[model samples]
Target: MDDASDKYRAPALEKGLDIIELLANHGEGLTQRELAKSLDRSPNEIYRMLSTLVRRGYVIRSASGDHYSLSLKMFSISQRHPPIGRVIEAALPRMRSLTRKAWQSCHMGMESNGDIVIVATAESPGNWGLALKTGTVVGLWNTGTGRVLAAFRTPEEIDDLIARHRRAVGEPEVVRAEFDGHLARIRTAGYEKMPSATAVGVTNLAFPVFNPSGQVVAVLSCPYLERVDDLVVPPIDEVVEIYRTLANELTALYGGTNPFEKDLTP
Candidate 1:
């Protein structure tokens, strides 16, 4: 930033970092031309950097060789760092228990920058269940997990989050008023339950998990599916109750209080 810092700046390294940051915000990936135009650089300038990133496994070139996105390697590296890694370790077992009890797959997501990143996931005990992979970046406004995270935060924080948001691929656009009202409903209900925007016949259930300081640290979400002709599966209501309890236990594990005990006057 200063003259001395500017003098030591490595242009190539900066270009690579710029590319990574851009890709991080845009989960859908971008073409080289798009990346160059957005970064105010010529396509030729970034070609070598892109090639290097692809070689290092930090970026993935789409099958058509036209677009690039951040690879799991970057997310994997972040998971290896402290606190995040520990959080995933602490949540996976509980998530697994929830999946087993509810007979549905579940995932824990946290707000990263402006997107919801799936930090950990647990598959259902049954052979067939929907499960998102860890490290997947989902839309901030179009997902149950993302809404639960926003619903528990202050209005200012939510607005800031909205400002920084970049829509993921195929993420539907939500009007500001509708999004605000949706968050209000989530707050009043103390959780979120709605049909999946991206999948058919799946209802998403999400609850906020708080830290010791009463701030939401993450959200646990289950994509509920009714087994066809399987009468023994837990009912949707029962699954909701089980999932809520699991979220509470996770909050308690972080030394936080039950959000239901607090006034939720949205």
Candidate 2:
């Protein structure tokens, strides 16, 4: 380790954070010994850290007193951030407008710990539109918005997210080259569209909201369903155009570039 790095290291804090991250990735609570093994540390080294975390309400200790899991504290704190509030403020009106015109329910989502979490939502004016409620989470490897979010992230981030995704979904390791190929195509397309991976008879149309730095800050997606009763619903092609225009306008307002303008290689 470098001299400067050695000069200021917070060993206790690092152990606490490691515990939080480990629990965040795993569904099952871990016993102290299990945590130690997973983190490659001796159980005695982490016992005090786990106790402090539980006392602070960041980690919950089971009644059996042998296992620990993350509490909702981090999720709660994230909701207090002002930028997320601003994004929701700017997006709600536009999303509501889309619902009226396209007659499809729409939601804004963003990646959170390798999953897409719905942040804002607008229901269709008509009675029969699909809606994914705010706070709902979808897997990184499963949904259209999730793919768009993944496609635009840096290569290293993509790999890390994929690793977490495998843990979250219980899938075998996905070959890196094949996954990268999909992301490259998605980056060129500027969006992702496919039948709903978890639902029947619906299509997911998703686009990214990028910031001025050309980084995606959030995702805008719609669960489109043809209303059999209306008989005048926008066709899928027109729906794509509407979402593209809306996404482009939103991206510009957020001061971000549409990467599709640079390439349509796919």
TM-score for each predicted model, relative to the true structure: 0.80, 0.68
lDDT comparing candidate 2 with the true structure: 0.80
Candidate 1 residues 1-266, lDDT tens each?
A: 89999999999999999999999878899999999999999999889899999999999999999999999898778888775676678889888877878889999999878878899999999988999988788878888998988988888999898888778777888688989998989878898998998889999988888888888888989999988774588889998888888788888877888668455321
Candidate 2 residue pairs in backbone clash: none
1-266 per-residue lDDT for model 2 (tens digits): 99999889998898999999899767579999999999999988889889899899999988888889988787777767776776777889988988888888899888766667788899999867788877666766667787788888888888787766633343334566766776776776778777887789999888888888888888888888876663698888787878777777888877677867545321
Over 4 Å off, model 2: 1-77, 165-178, 261-266
Q: What is each predicted model's overall lDDT from 0 to 1?
A: 0.87, 0.80
Q: Find the candidate with the highest TM-score and give its number.
A: 1
What is candidate 1's TM-score against the reference? 0.80
